[model samples]
Target: MMRSIFSAIIFLVLTRVVYAIDPRWGQGCTYIDRTEQIYCFGGEPFSENSQQILVYALNITGNSVLDLSEPQWTDIPGDPNGIRPSAASRFTFTGFPGTDTFYIQGGIVCTSCNYNSGFKYSVSSNQWNQTNKNKPVVDASSALVNDILYSFGGQTSPLTGYDQSNTTYRNTVYYINAKTGADGPSVKPQNETQLPPFTWASSMVYSYVYRSLFIFGGKQLSATEVTASMSDITVVSPQTGVYSKWKNIRSTSGSLPPARWGHSTIIDSSNRTVVMFGGCNDSGKAMNDLWLFNLDDAVWSPQETTGTPPTPRCRHSVVVLGKYMLVLFGGNDGTFNSDINVALDMTTWKWTNAPTNILPSDSSPPIDFPNSSSPQGSEGINEGGDSSSNISGGAIAGIVIGSIVGEDSSSLCLRNETDI
Candidate 1:
């Protein structure tokens, strides 16, 4: 009898020792280097055969060290009385540099409509306050540079259909004041200056090295044709005036990744390199391939990673920590997943355990923009050289095959689930 009790106790302890993976999708997340905490806002708790989509304004934080080595997840509930942001997905959740506050921007409400409302959450106060201004709602990718939040190339509200090109894709660039989280003056360049192609679901990263924004892999759509420019790397350098210089970087060799959307791209300040991970390819397939772009050399290199890598997915959130480790969180792989809390050590190009001694010192921005601003030399031509002409305009019909159960290729909104 004593032996049976001891065996039962051992079984219970073993089960308790297993790591926990949160199940969610379409969450807005960002990492605060100062506090070493990752904040994720509203997300849809996903499951196969689940009809009801529950979006919660739950602030999920990974405290202490999210080194991928025994990382911890905590639910920091907001004040019950404070007005919370509406439950939504594909919203922009980003943090301001040098502060403990993070902002949540426009997102799609559960009923498939988009909202332009804005709210700011204070980690220190544990409260959420609505922003004073509301901008035009969009399904765009945004990045912060010098206190300004620039949203590029996303469809505006009243989402028609995911695969439709005529009214769905946008090349409009919206500039919002990061201070008040409100719309600002037009930053769009003149018709003569190079402009980025009309695209949505693409990822954009600001490079302090060149004072430019690098965009990669989103479905580029146009009327009359559905072509995608997955091979070219578009760079938009914002200048002092309204006119920003745009250029496309083509791979001199064959190491560049194919056209994909819903991928995550982040910059490594230490080396002036951009790391890109999985996204849905043009053929409606999820990829787990990893590639690195040497910003200095203007070269693309495929990373040969070892150890257990995360499963193939898109719409996942990633943040670089310890200056070398890239930590990844929730995403979708045919189905929604919250169990992915992994890291890639860029130094060794290996998928190894997080080093306990390596605590990130620099206050890296929420989106992995390098901490330094030293000018790295440029390779492409200047302002007047329009790169938009290089884009082979056309949209691909049925570009994304829904991997989630009960979802078909024709389902809009949820098909391109947004992430940070």
Candidate 2:
């Protein structure tokens, strides 16, 4: 089944002009623990002029043990009378905790244009409603905490056909009320004078143990200079909607991972660590190395993961389900691909194209909600279930730095300015 899926993906890439089943790249996806579904939206399709306008859902767990190699996928349409959001790529897609609603923000609309408007979607109503205009950002990273969504640095202007001469990169931070769609006032660290770099196409994840957000590698573009990739880490505490300050944390023990952009990251609360994987390196080549960041001591350690890993690629999405399983989806590797790769057992650091683990049959989810303070204390879950699972889990969408198609028929490259 895995081989067949790969074969079909290759065939579709060669023969199909439109990507309806799985988007090419730059689409965001998040897993809904309550519904046991993964929702994806807004990506560039195979046809350069086309976009993925529909929402795609994939079932992560089933009635009993399931084969992840041939997972089930479904497409959902918005309400007929509602105004659906205009199609764009590399936008932020995140679920509002304790609700069925998801919010989407700015993205690339054309080679020279970007959309700064926001949109809200409800899974129960199957609807899409345009909200207030959001901060102008494409290829940015975001995370939701206590009903508020915070977005980090990204491109504010569309790339001028691969040239950064006229492009604008922002170091500003933006926040919004996920439930009310009300924009939060501009925020700055109360105690710090410096802010995070003007970064875009980076990966970010929130740590429950530390009560802060960790942002890693991406292109750093400023008026004075342009750095291809960076290896530093920035941590910010958005305490109850207002930020306290930003701190730079660098590894002091060992060699750090090569700086890269368009990567994916997830927090492992059980181990007090952050896991990072595959991205395009500074030399414009895709990489598949895995690295772990120890939150306790600020050290970097490389992991020799077992099993044949997915092909090296960048601009992919990754999400943690249950306690230890990390599921990875579509990415761009010179060519766009639609494939599912899994780190089936994080404790053992094993990778697989096929999975045999069975989801719990009880009414409760297999992972713990990140916002809850104690077992069975999560705010918005249904009345009764085995709410005691201690595993840390949250929705993390895949991120891309937006893409620009080369003039040639076969080449698709990252937004023409950068090497990758």
Candidate 3:
């Protein structure tokens, strides 16, 4: 009986000692399979005006294979000679498969101020270089298919005269060569064919198997009023230098999630389905529900998950590691910024919080309130949609910086930016 109790205590201690560290929510993050590493960069941290790049090396299991471990966050230094992007939120990061390069584009630098320029980072070199000189309009939804990056439905706010009432939303679609950062010839909208309504903060994912880019809910704003949420799903296919006319998939069966913006969606290539979670509704309330859309059958179904879920939030990052696990980190739970990390198993639909001791020390100062709009919102637009035009401008000031929250005793070598 004594031996059983002792063994139980040991098991609990081991399980609790390796918790995943938390990052400031609203940053852009993506997993690079080539290095078995996850890179997160740029976002508003609490009370600070600058943002930094952060990296995490996933723990591996037996046989030299890549496996998920509680991620230990590390601060990656900026390149002295490289063009570092200003700290901001609502930017898009797309990883180019088979290469160590990822692209960042179209985020706001301040309330009502947006960046159209794009930059590329080489994981192997740990440096940043300007991509296409032709800036993409900010707040656009993008996806990387084949070697091309496609952007759709963003708004442009002028630097000087930026005002929420004067912002312009677009239905035009643009493409850029992912490898060379040059503009691909634009495809004109099909004649007499209507496109998806002008929207921003929509989520998009590209499925290689189906060769289609799927776009989900976003908000549409007009001079007179605001459409806080949209339910239409638009599909576009890119071929050679052209794109197919947008097709709206109207669900004939199963229930659709409430139309909301700032939710995160990821493609489960193994299961051939898209999973979505957490965003704010038209009422500006944060959500915690999980929803799944089957690409094969074109059906949307809510997923009932087991285990303690992260608090409801929006603007967080979610990435698929390997075939079945989804890693979700950061976001604001309406009132406070959240630094929680949680994962969902696709096969069994179970949620697991990465263990605890590996978490950053609570002694660190409390994070500052996020002062930027949803990377998709205009100067006065809330990160999550709110019907009232009475938006808070106080939270749209200073930039947020990311830092290593805890000590890492592991022997992993810190590579210099030049040596990357």
Candidate 4:
């Protein structure tokens, strides 16, 4: 009897220890150079099935995703009222010089949300602060650009539930200063910018690859009513002043992503290709077709991706880490905690056969820093033709040079999953 009791106690202790060290995907991951870490936010529950552990990586260097090592969960709670928000949305994690952390912009605390609200997270302190502004009620569209957060569409009232096929839109753009010091003076949102009533077709399906944010395709922006007549790419550059102008990239191609708002997009950095998968059609019909966008050329080319893209999903959480773009865990797709992480390898153009839960050791070649020198003392390209300003090393790391002049693909994946 004494031996059995001792053995049982040992097993229980081991189990608890392993649970504490489980590899948490977190809501999603971000870079925390100030902390000398890579931080990942937890995915939110649009419903009960959407909850997951939020995590952070402390020992990262260079551009290798492997730098994140494995993720460890932070001791944070998802209670909507909790100071450390586990769930997140359109919040921008902008880092500044002299500090090794990123500031969370505006986002909704949807741990138990029926709609949306305002909240922010701090990486250094692992804290979330309730903002002064209660966001304008909009169900589907919101994004963070620069120091401001913007919500584009969705109706606040007469809505008790969420419908991925929702087309009702507020088309109002709300902005907030995200860089305000944590304990510094109070900040105010600039004037609200409103646009024409839009269809919320893209809300359910979209990705944030590239930079300066762009929406590839979607229906009318309003809910309560749905429209499938429009399918054009709309872009909003945070750099634009006053009101960020929405530029329409009209497409003449007969091929588009089938008027979607909930499908997700992933940037294949290795190939400069945009992969979009799963969303309902304009008429409340769920779809599972996969599409690819050539951001370099501003063109959408459809691809027949294999190995089971989740069955007709919308409102799913996808993230880019290492060389694999992991697509797993989302709802309105028959089940949640689907417990599957699909790894798509860009170099091989094939999916790997492994438990999504089990990923290989992360790896990526370091940037060729020494090769960074300009051609033997010759100044690089100038504004006119004279000696140009020297481009700093940090500038080179974030620089995207190619045919793509649009959103950050990784940002698109996070934005779509931002409500998490």
Candidate 5:
């Protein structure tokens, strides 16, 4: 099955050259429209000094990969601050139905708490504005349940190193209400709530079966040379409707992913399973193996896919693209985050490397959400049918710069610049 999948991918890339993806894109956020279109928003994958939102269209009508365009750009309205926060780490935006706005959560904030500043982009007007939802600005290891966002284990507001052990922010789990209108839930979840024990680098996700937030592996310190392994389970129910209390998501022993951080956890509705991959281990080991938990049977099973899933790597971004294929982007390999793109065909359990885009040294967007200054790519993500690029990194002494994945992430960060 794996061989067949690999062959199919190779054949498609070779024979069907018409669908090839351009390499000049560098990198940006993604908004995939099933088999029709893939809208890539701006970000910094190049020099970190730029910011502008660029949109690329992957038309699947006549072919697969389509034309790239520089449509209307939103300048983030005003001068929010210095170099845009790297979109690195964890990023997932929830769109409220009735409203034309969506909530962008915890991600790289200029290596500082800058990313802690959430903004709302109007899809209809193509405008950007600041949002009030700015608090626990940690990323890379949080989860979602119901509408409320469950933030646990991951890098804290990089300011004072880790926020754990802090009286106000101890081993805590925060639940952000997803209400978009008035007359919502009364007793809301606050940041003051703490947990029995805390962890960073752990993967948090939503479990439909349990109707709560499910958390996976994580470490003790957010940015440490050493890490404490955790088999401990932690779950947080929303304070709103049908929200459950904090319970151990589940605690199982035996060989797991091997104490690591930067791993990605995805909810696979097609297979009714939760998937995890890639994260540096205790001994600075990165993982490339794929594991799945059967939601129906409550089993933690590592998938024995056929083709070579990328070599054991950590910090790679993975998201459910097609029904069975999960799209994985550049991630850390114990050395640095790569710029390669690959797809995992869940049905056949195979790894398919996608086309690579090469960007010109001079051809850069005003806002780069992907690649940035330090030759360090921060992060990027898809939101509201629009792609947002942010660069996040702990480069500055007191700042965690946003390092985006693609080559041009900074272009998206320069929203207010008259020169982006």
Candidate 6:
């Protein structure tokens, strides 16, 4: 009888240790070099609504460890009555240099409602503070350059009502200072520029080596039709109080990934290359391919990888740790959400799954937000202004087959799915 009880207790302890880890997708992740931790905020479970803000600290003795074991997640405490940003996706999070504060700006609150407000979170205080509320409501591409937050093309809410398909798409540029914590005058910027039409969901990464921002695929729409994927690569350099004109990059080597939005791009300043991965095409099928663009030579090349790659996904968050390691977490696979975390070795172009462990007893549960739903419907660039709806199973099958053949072939037609 004593042996039986001891065995049962051992089993329970083992199960608890294994089950302590929680997986999530669609959350925004950023690495804090000061804390040697990665902060992840706001995600969806199985494509449903979830509001979780947690941090994971690396298990390294010092800064010399090359391979890192998966760190446990700890919930950050927020003020009970203080202002907090509503849970949302497609937002941009930029950490201020030499500080523990990070800023979240412009995201889709609902299928038709995009937010214009900005919020800041201090890692040291574990609190959130509302900043500017008058910023443009955009689900667009943004990058931080020289302590200035620059937001580019995205869609605006329609004045006529909740028409998701007929909203206005913008290529205008706006900037705001990152150090200010108030929402009043300091949040607004006088620097603004109008450019050619560019749609939402594009990805941008600032290259300090080149002193410019590189923009990848986004969609373009008109009253009658939408261009689902864009092939042109645009580079913007911000000058004193203004940004230079958008310059299209001419590729001479390998083919570009099918025009896509909801993808991620990160710059490795040490290698002088921009790494891109996983986004959906017009047909709404997720992708798992990897590609790299050499900034010095202006060449795009497909990366052949080894080991297991994350499943095809879109709207995921990725951060480069140190110079050669890239960590990607959480995303939608078109039909469902993913909680998988994967790491890539840039030197060898190898992929590996991140290790997970049980959470400690001191960890807290994520704070819940009220009245939030799974965000649906694509933002900006609706093809034929169709009503936002889920893609039929038959349409999804066709997309998979089309992707297998070729994105530029006649079999593939640019289509929009419900937004991520």
The Cα error of candidate 5 at residue 53, in Å, is 5.9
RMSD of 5: 15.5
* Per-residue C-alpha lDDT of model 4 across residues 1-420, encoded as one tens digit per residue: 563454344333322221122222113334333443334444344335454444433333233333112322233333444554324533323333234334443234454433333345554444556554433233344333333334344443323223343323344333445455322222221223322345342432112222334444444534444543224444443323112222332333565556755455544422234466665565545565655554334445555455645445554434433444545434443334343335455434445433232222224431121111121111111112222211121211110000011222111111111120
lDDT of 5: 0.38
Top candidate, metric lDDT: 2
Compose the digit string of candidate 1's lDDT tens values, residues 1-420: 563454344333322222434555556665543344455665554333223322222112233333454544545545656666656666665766557677776655544333546778776566778775454344467775545666666664543212222344455455656568666654324332444456777777655445455666677754532324545566654553222323334454564577678777765533256677887776656777887766655556777888877777777666544534443444554575444666666655677544433444434222222222333344332322221211011100000100000001110011121222
Tens digits of per-residue lDDT, candidate 6, 35-127, equal 545556654442233333333323212223333334334455355566676655556567654466777765555333335377888765656
Candidate 3 TM-score, C-alpha based: 0.68
Q: Write model 2 residue lDDT over 206-251, tens digit each, in one string.
A: 6555545567787776554443333566665554222222223355
Q: All candidates' TM-scores? A: 0.70, 0.72, 0.68, 0.54, 0.57, 0.66
Note the Cα lDDT for every prediction shown: 0.51, 0.55, 0.51, 0.37, 0.38, 0.49
Q: Write down the TM-score for model 4.
A: 0.54
Sort the candidates on lDDT, descending order.
2, 1, 3, 6, 5, 4
| CA RMSD, predictions in order | 12.2, 10.9, 15.8, 11.3, 15.5, 15.7
By lDDT, the better pick of 4 and 6 is 6
Model 4: per-residue Cα lDDT at residue 293: 54
Which candidate, 4 or 6, has the higher TM-score? 6
Candidate whose TM-score is highest: 2
Error of 2 at 251 (Å): 6.2
**Over 4 Å off in model 3, which ranges?**
1-23, 45-71, 110-116, 158-166, 191-193, 222-231, 240-255, 270-272, 333-339, 355-420
**Candidate 3 Cα RMSD after full superposition onto the native fold (Å):** 15.8
